[model samples]
Target: MTQTTLTSVQFVKSLYEAFAQGDVPTVVGAMDEDIEWYEAEGNPWHPGHAFVGSQQVVENVFARLAQEFEDFRIDCRRFLADGDTVVVEARYSATRHRATGKPLDVQAAHVWDLRNGKLVRFQQYVDTRRLADVMGVSNY
Candidate 1:
């Protein structure tokens, strides 16, 4: 039997599907050991630096999101791929902010870089002001 590898777009789409199904392990499992994940610069989740490694991304970004939002979802609108890079245009929606009880709906884009079928780098782009407003964060 031959093992079929996913294309960059397929790999990224699979990660989003996994995330939508609440499969954190599968999402994190696809990342390269030294992956560098960056949240949008002005987004509330940004830590002023990239989250290095799967563990750091899971701990700082995923875990915090799980704890902070209710019914959060990513609705992917399009996927564009070229070489090892894949870009996803999407929207983020959450029923409510856990702490502030505010609803969230915002457009987002994600850039994924893969090497040898392993996700090596990720960068996020989103409406920071909208995100900040929903989170009741004034300083974004």
Candidate 2:
């Protein structure tokens, strides 16, 4: 049996779909071995450093998200691809913040860089103040 590899845009879309279904293994499987994942600067998960490799991302980002938010979802609005880079404009919605009980609805952009069809790097851009407010964290 021959497996067909997905294009960059299709690969990114598949990742989102997997994430929506709570399929963390599938999402992590698409990442490059040395993948670098960055949360927005003011995001509570941003520890002044990048989460290198799939294990770190799963441990630090995905796990924390599951622990901190209720009914969290990513609504991808648009996907733009340029060679090895793909940009997704999306909105994040959560029923409530686990710590603060605040509802969350925020727009965000995700920039993904792929190398030979493997996701190599991810940079997230989001409304830090709103996220902070929902998480009951001081943005300043």
Candidate 1 per-residue lDDT, tens place, 21-123, comes to 9999888888889999999999988989999999999889888888999999999999999889999999999999999999989999999988876888999
How does each model score on lDDT?
Answer: 0.89, 0.90
Off by over 4 Å in 2: 1-4
Tens-place lDDT digits, model 2, residues 45-68: 899989999999989989888999
The candidate scoring highest on lDDT is: 2
How many angstroms is residue 20 displaced in model 2 relative to the true structure, after the best TM-score fit? 0.4
Estimate the TM-score for candidate 1.
0.95
TM-score of each: 0.95, 0.95
